[model samples]
Structure formats: C-alpha cells, structure tokens
Target: MTHYRSFVALGDSFTEGLNDPAADDRGGAPDRFRGWADRVAERLAALDPEFRYANLAVRGKLIDQIVAEQVPLAVGMRPDLVSFCAGGNDLLRPGSDPDRMAKKLAGAVRDLRATGAEVLLFTGVDPRDTPIMRRARGTFAIFYLHVRSIADLYGCRLVDQWSMQGLRDWRAWSDDRLHMNEEGHRMVAAKVCDVLGVPTEDDWRMSWPPRERVDPRVKRREDVQWVRSHLGPWVVRRLRGRSSGDDLDPKRPDLKPFG
Candidate 1:
C-alpha cells in the first residue's frame, strides 16, 4: 500500500469548502473555515489513526495567488500527500482568458512539484446543463482540460472531481444554487479518500438526487442581464483603449472577475 506520513491541501474556495452547510454543524467547523481539503483530511484520519493532515486553502484565491502564498506553505510542511481543488472562480465570468488561467495553473503545479510532494490535482465539474450556470461551464471545461494536461506534463495524479458523484445530480448542491451541501461534501471526501487509497465506511456512498431544470430562455435572459451589469462597461472600456489589465491592477487583491 502507498504510504504517506503527512497530507496537505492547497487551492481556492472549493478546496476550502465554501458552500457546505454541514460545516457549520460540525464541531470543527471545517466548512466555514476548512474546505474539501479539510474534509479529505478528516476522512484520512478516520481511515488511518496515524495520518497527519493540514489544509492551506483560502476562499476566492486564484491560481497565481495560491502559488505565491499556499504553495510555499505546503512546501514547508514537507507533506507526502497533497491535493488541490481550484479554477472555479476563474470560470465565473464570461470571456475570462483561459490561456492566462492555464499559465498560472501550470506555474502552481511546477512550484508544488519542486517541493518533491506527491500531488493530486482535482478538476471541477462542468455546469453546462444548468440553465443559469451554462456559460461558465464552457470556460470551466477549457480550464479543467488545460490543468489536466499540465498535470500529465508534471507527472502528478489527476482526480476527476467533475466526474465524481453530485455533479450530474443537482440536488447535491446547496439552496444558493452554486455551492455543494453536506451530502456533496461527503461525496467529495470519499472520492479524495479513494484516490489516496484510504479506506472509508460504507455510509460514505453518495446518492444522486433529481435536479430542477430551468427554462433555457429564462437562463439566457439572466445571463445577458448579468453580463450587461458586470462585463458590459469593462468590455466597452477595453474597446475604447482602457484595457482590463490597466483598469484593474493585477497586484490588487480585490480585482477578481465579478460573477
């Protein structure tokens, strides 16, 4: 069996467990403070009494920020096992540059690999089928594919989080219609355990619930309105010689793409 003395997780909100409702109820409150990475750590501890784990994920963090902050912290930990779940926020807005995102992801992988840690990279689910969530899914797929290719290039293990349970079944998500709920968190924890060769209880099995479908026309109108409110001015300004890069300094922490 594969042996890892310590585990570390690095990435963004999905990695941090943003939408899990159960996190508030749990004594440790990982969902609010921890994330999927912390949940995976909890599962690992349950499987092996001796396993040690730490989560370094932060909410709303992009690949570049992770590399600059979390990557060094993870390297310092000298963990044997490491997993990363990111790229969701990168897909939130339409016309966000995929090539730039991919480049930043590649840097993150390379930096982590330099620490000599065995890394597991997770690709997020495609949200295309969801009426209001469709546009971002296309961009998500592109980002995921590129990250997978980067993992292959770096000889890292790739976890197919997008294909895991709860993605196809919308009921796994929370009432907000974006984040995953308690059941969703459990499913994610189970999948990470499987990838790490950790044993889990039978109760860990996930069930897909019926999804609510919305009218495509309504979703389209909503998308148009969202874009007009968020990206319209930015696009117009870019066309008029005010570039996005210029308007929002890359170094500014609050300059992320608004959904």
Candidate 2:
C-alpha cells in the first residue's frame, strides 16, 4: 500500500471545489468550497496524523494559466502526491483544439512526474446527457484519450470520471450544470481513495435509484432559465475576455496539516 505524507492539488475550479460548498455554505473565501481534493486529503490524514495538504486552484482558469501559475508552485512543494485536473475551460472556448490542449497538459504532467511524486490525473466527466456540454462530447473524448495515454506513459494514477456511471444523473451536478454538487464531490472523493488504495467507508460505485421522468414543459422552462441565468453571463464574460478568477488567489498556497 502506498502512503502519501503530503499532497498538493492543482488546476481550476474543480480542484478548488466550486459549487460543493462546505457545511456552512458561506459565499466568499476558499474554505467555503470543500471539494473532492479536500475530502481525499481528509481520508489520507486519517491514515497519517502528520499528513500535509495544499490546494492551489482558482475558478475559471484555463489549462495554460494553471500550468503557468500553479504548476511551478506545486512542483516546488515536492509533495509525495499531486492531483492535476485542468483544460475544461479551454475546451469550452470556440475553435479550441483538443490535441493542442492535451499537449500542454502532458507537459505539465511530465514536470510533476519529474519530481518523483506520484501524480494523479483526472479524465473529464462524461457529458453525454448534459445540454450545452453534450454537444462537445467529441472534444472531451479526444482530450481524455490523450490524458489516458499520458497517464499510462508517465506511470501516474488516473481517476476516470467518464466511467463513473452514477455521475450521469442530473442530481449529481450543481444547478449550473457545469460543476459537481456536494453529493457528486463526495462520490469523486471515494473514487480517488479507491484509485490511491486508501480505505474509506463510503462506496463510490453504488447504483443510483431509478430516475423519474420530468415533464417536457418543465424541462423546457428549466432550460430557458439556465440559459438566461448561466449561459448569458458566461457568454458575456467570454466576449469581454474576462475570467471569474481574475481577482482570486489560491486558497491554500502552502502545504499544511489537514484533516
């Protein structure tokens, strides 16, 4: 069994734990967003009281930004384990090339692995049922293929989100239909533990209950609301060349004892 004395997580909002707010559900600050990385760190801490953890993630960052900003910091920390997940923002942009993005990510992975740390990479979640995301399933698939290949070549642990069938359910996602909800984060934490050979009481692969069909009219109304509340703002930001993380900083910049 491999044990990690320290873990550093890097990437965008997913690593930062965006929609999966902590119990208090406060609006500002990074601690309010306790995500899968935090949960996984908690599990690791249980095994070793001296475990140290750091999360250098900011919301709305593209892969290039992560590589340029977070990658060097994480490498300098020289943790026993590193979790890297980025590029979703790049894929969402118009005319973005999956192959190019994959190349960038592969470079970052190579650097992390060079430190002799056990690196963990994540595949983009399967978006077959998601509305706007479903259209770009091919892009996501192409990127994931490269990710899988990179992990194999570099001898890294992979948490294949695409194979997590339970995640296909709408309930598993936040209302934005982009980031995962608390339940979804919980499941991913267990999956990460499973991949890392960490023991946890929770079962990540339990089948979800049968889903009840939604009325077509209600679904249509919901779609309209989502477009107005979420999509509209997203488009505006894209046009303005602005990012949500423009003024934000990494929540946990230093490796510290965590539980």
User: Which one wins on TM-score?
Assistant: 2
Q: Which ten residues in a row are the worst by lDDT in model 1?
A: 250-259
How big is the positional error of residue 209 in model 2, measured in Å on the Cα after superposition? 1.3
Tens digits of per-residue lDDT, candidate 1, 73-139, equal 7777777787776666556655678779888878777877888888898787668655555866667
Q: Which stretches of candidate 2 lie over 4 Å from their true place?
A: 24-31
TM-score of each model, paired residue for residue: 0.72, 0.95
C-alpha lDDT score of every prediction, in listed order: 0.66, 0.91
Q: Residue by residue across 101-210, what tens digits does model 2's lDDT show? A: 88998999999999999999999788888877788889999999999999999999999999998788878889899999988999999999999999999878978888
Name model 1 segments beyond 4 Å from true. 21-35, 47-50, 202-205, 209-259
**Model 2: how far is 99 from its true place, Å?**
1.4
